[model samples]
Target: MCHAHFEDKYLCRNNRISNIAVPTLKMRSPLTPPSTTSLQQLNLGHGPSPSSLTATMQEAALPSTSETNVHLNLGEKTTVKKAKSRVFLTNTEKYLQDKLVAASIKLSKMKNRFKKLSVNVKAAKQIASNPAVCDILENCTSTRKLLISMQCQEDHKKEKERRFTLQEKIASLSIFKQSPKGYRFLRFFLFCLLSKH
Candidate 1:
């Protein structure tokens, strides 16, 4: 494994154990062979060293103590007791102000949405009240076009008829006014009609 991977695993392993030691080998030059002098100095039972023998014997004779375990446990516990901190520790006044601002914004958005919905409802009511407005509100392009064209044609015919009748009445009045005999006749006819009434 890579150095980072090895350390991550080692740290995780150390977190679980109360007291453990993992020995790692130090890197040495590849060209150098094992040095007998170094091994001999450490007194690895190869050559007789009286002082090293006594030191090794003394360590083996002693009992395992609770002091080492206590020290190791304390060292590992520091990371757990490092005073838990909160991410957001705002004062009461500041928190209340933030909540009020948020509520106001939410209220504004809801009011806007309600206004839009009311406007749509009002428009739908208006469309429903009048048949022509309802017909105009149809989504189909061809149907609306056809209805508008027919209405226009009917209006044009009515306008033409009204104009024709108005023109006929005007022509008859002009002719009657041009001749004195026709004017006298019209006066006699009006007098008779008024007398009957």
Candidate 2:
């Protein structure tokens, strides 16, 4: 019975070793014939170093802090520029306000002058329309009208003398023609001495 038990244990151990050895043999079979090119390609002497590849991956994964800082600085500069422009605009607005105030003052003065001129014109029109004022002006200017009438009479007398001279010349020419008799005959006899014809 001891021999029978020892034989069973030997068979179990053999089965376990075969099971373990089969996978180990399969796993070792591919590695046992080492391809020198494949080994050299994986080793440090043939390909890019692991340190440079890790650094490239790390740089790709991280965000750029300097680009964000530049954007922040640009934003601050724009804000400062805007503040300066606002100050300039405020100063210009104050200047315009002062100019507007001065212009308004001048406009008010012009309005007052127009009011005075309008009042004076209204008073003059009113006085001219009043019959009492008209009579007063006419009475005060009687001597001036008398002088104007005297000058008009002198002009009329000069016109009458020129007309009389023209009539006399016309009568002398008609007497020389002697081809008439009635009112013209009486006018010729009164103005001309008859010659025998």
Candidate 3:
């Protein structure tokens, strides 16, 4: 849709060099109905009761699979209660699982190798489901521990360097007042100075 603005040219990001990034946009997607009012317009402090809000949400939500139940006996009507499934993975583990899968994909496709894009459980499952992707991602889990160990090592090295640089920069860094906007040029990147020389 932004073709008019871009003039059919791809988006470009500049660092030391220019990199063209082609963005993927899903078209003809269903749009949600307009909201009755904005959050700022409502009295959030005492707008609605928690139970009432929950009930409203449930009413608005689509019917779930659990709501549909099969009954063998037509003569007698009965209700069956289903127990909630237990969650085995914690929030952090679930997060890392997704990241792990994405990373593996991007790494696979590097020079003479598949550039692994992601390393996560969901991505891994998707890749495993595809015979073609599986052919490419044969050693996903076998290298998981290795990838994690390498990540930890890199983090440790960066942290040690940062601390050492910060100690050295403290004596040299001079404090100066900033602009009228109250933002100034950062003397150090996250308190660790990088030498230009």
Candidate 4:
């Protein structure tokens, strides 16, 4: 009876010690084995073999269903595989198919419209830069081709006018330096030369 009591007390102490140690063991190394050495540490490379690693990885990977079967029993005659059953569509299914097709066509048209809209936006931006082009665009509102042609003509006219003005300024500056006194003196000298001639 005394030995039995002592054994129970010893077992209780051991249980208490294990409960305390388990928490510390988990805290110290979460992945480490409770025993001193693991299988990986005991191995020469301190890791699993490549073949085993591949095998374990394959085992861990999700299993896929196999549709093809090659094996056949010798006693049983080889039977030809049955063809797939024909799919019969309900009225609702047919309606849904039609709706989906129409939706896809509408989506394609919308995409084309969006592309055209983007092109138009780019064209509008190009035209908006020049007030002459804008005025021409506003005035020539008959047809797109006519409006574009008129705007182009107006742009060319403005460009020619700008070039002519610049050339005139350059020509005047070339005849005399751009100081008021110098310009007046040059005009007076020209006037005296013209009078003597």
Candidate 5:
């Protein structure tokens, strides 16, 4: 009886060891076995061999039952038509080429205009610096000064308008501050505003 019990225990231990070892043995390496079908699918430098092409043609010629029935039901028959290579350029391609040419012309014109503007600006600066040209410019300086003063007055007017707007905002805020809820709301709003800044 003791020998039978020891044999049962030994069998249980053997089963446990096998359960552990079997999984480790089954856990194969990440490197997989290469497949012949995958290798055949790969496109090497040259086109498919004559035999491969014939095999493909045979496969294509053999229609499925469903496809064959559909063709028959439609009163049509399967005919092997030679696949034609497509020539794709349309009107849009010609339009794009024309647009590209126009853009290049426009870019060249813009470059020329920029060069002309630079030359004119340089000449204007040099003329303004020369004593003879300075005398002529000085004669016109009074009119130019009037123009500058007019511009300054316009700027001042805009500044005053901006200041008035700011003052109105401040006055509105002061009026709101008198109310208890407004004061709390303003404080919360200011806190958020300051945190954002």
Candidate 6:
């Protein structure tokens, strides 16, 4: 019913198919609409126009063709990409240079973080020392707090060991002395775990 809705019927009650001057239509398939040239030849006075019938049946709307999808098929159309070579640390001196540079950057960041945390912890200790909070302080020894204290101690121990390791590495690098400037890099970076007085 939906397919035939577009095509209107206009057969006279007395007229028959053999009596008409128009030739019989050739149907290629039951589903496909008749060819546009054949449909254009038809002139039913009251039916919808041939242009309207062809417009609806033209290939479904498409964004682009296969040729448009390919961008770099031609030499003139294609652009080269930025290329880089992989660098393996084969030279000991080149590897050492990169290692020293990275270690210096990491050392400065570690020192700053350690200093800030120490200041906060010192302020917290002073705050806890207030005489008015003695009753609350006496009752503050919970299992959770004990576990937290143990974790803090372990973290502090690890921090001290890491600082010693850094010092050892810097000391070991003393073998590579510069001919012009001497080992100023070692003196500049070798940090000590100084205790707060």
Per-model TM-score, in order, reads 0.22, 0.24, 0.14, 0.28, 0.26, 0.26
Better of 3 and 5 by lDDT: 5
Residue 70's lDDT in candidate 2:
91
Task: Return the clash pairs for model 1, or none.
Answer: none
lDDT of 2 at 47: 71
Candidate 3 lDDT by residue in tens digits, 123-196: 85775699986565455663343333334334335643533334233332332222312223332322223333
In order, the Cα lDDT scores of the candidates are 0.56, 0.59, 0.47, 0.52, 0.55, 0.50
Instruction: Kindly report which residue stretches of model 6 are placed more than 4 angstroms away from their true locations once superposed.
Output: 1-90, 140-197
Supply the global lDDT for candidate 5. 0.55
**lDDT, model 5, position 35:** 90
By the TM-score metric, which is better: model 1 or model 2?
2
Give the range where candidate 4 is weakest over 10 consecutive residues by summed lDDT.
Answer: 188-197
| Each candidate: RMSD | 30.2, 27.2, 44.4, 26.6, 28.2, 23.3
Ranking by TM-score: 4, 6, 5, 2, 1, 3
> Candidate 4 versus the native: TM-score?
0.28
Question: Mind giving the per-residue lDDT tens digits that candidate 2 earns over 70-161?
Answer: 99999999999998887544888899989999999999999999999799789979978999977766886544443333343333344334
Worst 10 residues of 3 by lDDT: 175-184
Task: List ranges where model 2 is wrong by over 4 Å.
Answer: 1-91, 141-197
Worst window of 10 by summed lDDT in candidate 6: 1-10
Q: lDDT winner among the candidates?
A: 2
Candidate 5 residues 6-29, lDDT tens each? 333344443433222222223346
Stretches of candidate 4 exceeding 4 Å from the true structure: 1-86, 131-197
